[model samples]
Target: MLDLTSMKINDNNDNNDNGWLELALSSNKDNVKNLIEIKDRLILAYKNYENIITEYTTNPIKSTFLQERELLKSFYEKAPKNLNRNLLEQRNEHLFEQCPFCGRPCKPSILDHFLPKDLWPEFCIFPNNLVSQCDKCSTKKWSHYYSDIDNSVKFIHPKFFNLLQYIGIQIEINFPSPESIKQPDFIITFTLPRGININDKKRLSLHIKYLDIKTHIREYITENYLYWLRVSEQKRYYVPDSLNQRIKESYTGGNNNRWDVALYLAMINNDFIINHFDSIEIKKEIQDHSDIKLEILTEE
Candidate 1:
């Protein structure tokens, strides 16, 4: 789990929404035309709302508002079928990766709602409240309602949190868990600044709960363990001295260290390690082993 609060929203001036609209227009032109058949119905609904709003002279009645709501809903129901698909695809492409909480490469594996759409219908379509989430961190599953605080409804928007500065990932080995007796258990805790506001803390907690990040960490660790086990087995009976001698006799540079070969093989087989290993740790580990040197695969 990574803190990813600093992902910036693109400027509204840029052709973001318009681009999506254009894409939808081009791709679903025929469908859009078909939807035009309902234009008369939408116009009728709008006219009904206008008539109620204009003719009702008494104090605004509850029924009037309800009627207006129904009218708007009906209009939308009759709208184009692909009206929002392009926007959704565009958002998926642009906001799908990078943790919304920490703005890191946790590659937001999911879409997150800063505000529960069901509880806060007004904010359902609010762009600022939508965030990309990794599997281990999101707001969808975790309920944000707090009983202790009065008038506390809003969650800390990732746009305002700048999560990279406020949060850090801590991997706890052999962490105590209720399920420990049943299987290998570990916890990846997301540490945050101690003085963070209660609402922010709750928001972060919800993000973690929704993502099931601890599960992701366990899976990652298990996969690495198996990979290392395989490598260990491959080198169980190998004599490094004899291997190096054979290589020297044959004038081949490949068999210098079976241990090194084993480690490399293990790394290659582990997807999580290949994808998310700490570069700094790798550098320090390489430095500790005088027999090996780290090589830069890409320029920063």
Candidate 2:
């Protein structure tokens, strides 16, 4: 995922330059001091967001904050729309290039409220809380949470958190026999960087699991494998260095931000995939990795 540097700042000649934040606060202001109150609370919520993330601590359930959050929620309930189409388009096309979450290739179809609207409608239109994602990803993220107690689960935030730097996927291929290269076995696993604690690790694992990342990757692999199989008989796929080259190209295109980018890089780097370019390699077995366990991902 890309960093949050691309999010726009205001052109309003204001020194503070909180463009999106200022617009959100003023529009929601409703000409009442309550709007000012909500803005103040929003500032605090932003503070808490920063503290919780930077300090790596649990969220404190404060009553005052909760009441303000309710007010914010009520405001959203009667708002004109969830997001401004002009803003979404401007940001998606000019600012945010792609859905950083699933690494979908283009501007997303839906504007996802990263924190579910039902749970935290106060964050409904919050810039940092709003992530541009495809319909599929937006649907999958509905009400998804690793922990019910707190919002401390530092899962992949397409807005600020970049999973590309911290997590790397590894593909392992296990053959049933040494005789043939067709229809063997494979497993995909993830590796976390050093110094990451157990709680963070578990949270990251939960993120990948619930998103059905393995399933998505497995599906792509199978489709690609089938395509290669059909072509190999005619020597199209059997041509030396083609698979690796394609993978490299995809990785280069994505700059390692997309999951498929990592996946392709993994495939190219994998010795077994290089050795046997025509195998369908269904992931029917678990591999031996201390940090990551293989799951049986199905086509269905």
Q: Which candidate is the best by lDDT?
A: 2
How does residue 223 of candidate 1 score in lDDT? Answer: 64
Which number leads on TM-score? 2
Q: Model 1: runs farther than 4 Å from truth?
A: 1-86, 95-98, 102-106, 135-155, 172-216, 231-300
lDDT digits (tens) for residues 137-211 of candidate 2:
676778764455544553566445555345556655566777645564658777766888887776667666667
Model 1 per-residue lDDT at 296: 75
Candidates in order have lDDT scores of: 0.41, 0.54
For model 2, state the Cα shift of residue 171 in Å.
1.5
Tell me how far candidate 1 lies from the true structure as C-alpha RMSD in angstroms: 16.0
**Cα lDDT, model 2, residue 145:** 41
- TM-score, model 1 to reference: 0.42
- Per-prediction count of colliding residue pairs? 12, 0
